[model samples]
Target: MVAKNQTVVTEFLLLGFGDLHDLKFLLFAFLLIIYVMALTGNALVIVLVMIGQNLRSPMYFFLSQLSLSEFLFTSNILPGMLWLTLAGGGKISIIRCFSQFYLLAVCTVTQCLLLTIMSFDRYVAICKPLHYTIIMTFGLQLQIVTLCWSTGFILSIVLFGFLYRLEFCGPDTINHFYCDIGPVLELSCSDISSTKLVTSMLSTPLVVCPFVLITATYISIFNTILKISSSIRRQKAFSTCSSHLTVVCLYFGSLASIYIFSPKIGSNTKKNLSLIYILVTPIFNPLIYSLRNQDIRGAITKYIHLIGTWQLP
Candidate 1:
């Protein structure tokens, strides 16, 4: 093992949004605002769901978990990206890089699974009311949530392990914003064909299967709504599902466009689409879900008023 004399790279330059050199400061400030809002908004969702007695249902419970994941996910990627934008270079050690990649993969995949699980929960309640309680029992809900996170971590480590073995000869500049697997893999000098193939194949199960399941769940949900005799009942169902469906479409569409289809496209296109999910989707989740849901709106209004009316003396 002493024959090796290779100099390892100590840092990587992330060319995230690298084209707009002039607007880095402007973009940094703008993104900082969005990051703050996302953190506060999602945190608030978690707090409300946990504290409010009315939100004791499985749906709100899962929403709270989704909010928790989004908060951590945003924190994981955005701070480093912001630093890179300001400092011109962001250095991550080799071990740190692999750790970040694994965390990112776990969080990203968990969110995907959580969204699908949430959709299924809604589908059962709306389309199969008679069996909703029995099917979505507390123990089963806990199991589904646990499985989503566990599977995400298991897959993350497997993919990252293969990536860790490749040798990076040169061109240490990563093409995208974060330490995403694709750009890092492109840097490796060693034979990575099998790793590449495995990554793509591994991703398909997490990305495509869940999406198909979500689509199918919605199809049945919509069918049940259409069959409802009362227009008011149909409207109620649409009102609830509309916000959730909108979030699903935006998240799934952007995710598939970037990670699932990056093989067909190059880095630039992939990075552009990646922003939709990584940067923009977190900002959109609370807006789409909380703004339209009447209960959430009331809770938010009461929160604002309570804060506003409180004063010393």
Candidate 2:
């Protein structure tokens, strides 16, 4: 039974950080710094991977992809959030909301799939050191990366197709910094059983299944590392896995906290978790990789010296 006065919502008011009226500028400034660091750091990784001959391995290839995905992921969400923070709050058209949601979902799923592939790469490298080159050939790596990206885009379109069909008839406020599936669905007037089902189906394959695979891969990697006869080799193996493990923990931990357990938590808590998931993780990725990786650090140093020599004249 539809109300006679009910009408489709043309726009949604994003709550953003409106409650922090006194601290909006401070918040904006802080996030602005984070945004710049994230972009610069990820961009540096991409450039290093592209130009450094020593970084032409499968590991650095996947790292470059991860950095590129992080760039797009942050870009899609942060600029709009920064604007909202500067303005205190703002209305976004329904189309724009859906577009932002679609891009975010695509990048998120792509990153998950890419991370799984990288874990497999690590597994092959550590567990089968003799055959690493044969197994992780450039052709195979290309196929896997293409599959990850294509599947992510396809799944995103399917989810968006279903979501776009939902009706929003009043109460057109989104209680978050950006348009996420949960917040957007909360405002839908139409029945959401189908949407929920689709989300569950996609989420399991995109997040949970990949997470399990990554865990198993790391387990195999650790088992192999334990069998190494040399202590130095063992330390080297641990160093290689540590950075990826840190990122995995942060990425999946924040995601599960927000999407899985957030129902029992407060909105403020959820918002903060979203900030970590969306903002902080990307910024920390390059720092973790560069600081922990001798290869990356060496490449950066070499490039810096080259630039310094060029500028000396």
Which candidate's TM-score is highest? Answer: 2
Task: State the TM-score for model 2.
Answer: 0.97
208-309, model 2: which lDDT tens digit per residue?
888999999998999899999999999999999899999998998888887778779987788889999988889989999999999999999999998888
lDDT of 1 at 147: 92
Candidate number achieving the greatest lDDT relative to the actual structure:
2
Q: What residue runs in model 1 are displaced by over 4 Å at the alpha carbon? A: 1-6, 19-22, 309-313
Over the stretch 219-256, how does candidate 1's per-residue lDDT look in tens digits? 99999999999999999998988888888888888988
Model 2 lowest lDDT segment of ten: 1-10
Candidate 2 colliding pairs? none
| Candidate 1 global lDDT | 0.83
Query: Can you tell me which runs of candidate 2 are displaced by over 4 Å?
Result: 1-4
